[model samples]
Target: MAKRQPRDTLPTHIAQWRDQVRRDYGIEDAPGLILLEQAALALHRAEQARELLAKDGLVTRDRFDQPKPHPAAVIARDAEASFRAALRDLQLDVEPARPVGRPPGV
Candidate 1:
């Protein structure tokens, strides 16, 4: 019989995303790890809110029978912004490899 691998403590998507980010960015410090976690959670929240918005609608009728943007739209926007901010804070949103020195003829 094959030995069973231990289950991941984190949810599947979270673990997969975190591991991929870590591998892709070579994140090793505590602060980077924390920021990655924050970014992941924010992204998850944004996706969930987006899904709710899709299921319901982009607009809804208020008590006065006036149509307004769905509340989930705001939530999704905020969460996605938070995720982007976290990535910026972590310096993970930029190009992977940048040239180190000035041009030879400049």
Candidate 2:
């Protein structure tokens, strides 16, 4: 009998599946690129939110009172909190926030 791979190797399998989907769906060029770009943007925003929360310890309304905050900051904060909560529920290691001395340019 062949040895089975660990579940941790599933990501490679999933990527192959996604590649098959792209081929089967005939995904190419502009529209496909746009979708891929959007996915990348979403992932970038999620990472930003995660970092913000991890640095600031909490999202406060005051954070929005700054001279300029991207309009998406609030949405990002909410999403980050939800993600963290979900991680906690799943018994995953939730990264605790590290205190940042002061707001930027303060």
Candidate 3:
């Protein structure tokens, strides 16, 4: 019998997702990580769904004539929505507030 190898847990951690977001978005600040973390799980699922759809051409229904989005596409769509919403909610974090008053210690 073959010995079972330990499963890699990197994919399940938030830091991994954070790293992915950084690489994907070329983010350089903590705010970007924070935003991605908000929708980490959904983003991960969306990526997985996209990969599945790309590779398998998954068609949930073959008996019907009407064309429809693949199940993976649906998952990707919902996940993308969640990801975008998270980013939208954190827009302020990405754009720093400008100081309206005079310079300090002028």
Which lDDT values do the candidates have, in the order given? 0.86, 0.53, 0.72
The 10-residue segment of model 3 with minimum total lDDT is 7-16
Q: Can you write out model 1's per-residue Cα lDDT over 48-71, one digit (the tens) per residue?
A: 888999899899999999999999
Model 2, global lDDT? 0.53
Clashing pairs in 2: none
Flag regions of model 1 displaced more than 4 Å.
1-11, 94-106
Q: What is the lDDT of residue 34 in candidate 2?
A: 47
Tell me, by lDDT, which candidate is best.
1
- Stretches off by above 4 angstroms in model 3 are 1-36, 63-67, 92-106
Q: Which residue pairs does candidate 1 place in steric collision?
A: none
TM-scores for all candidates? Answer: 0.73, 0.36, 0.49
- Write one digit per residue (lDDT tens) for candidate 2, span 1-106: 9998763222344446445645665657676644533433444456666677667655344555745454357768665556455434434344767777986787
Per-residue error at 61 for model 1, in Å?
1.5
- Global local distance difference test of model 3: 0.72
* Candidate order (lDDT): 1, 3, 2
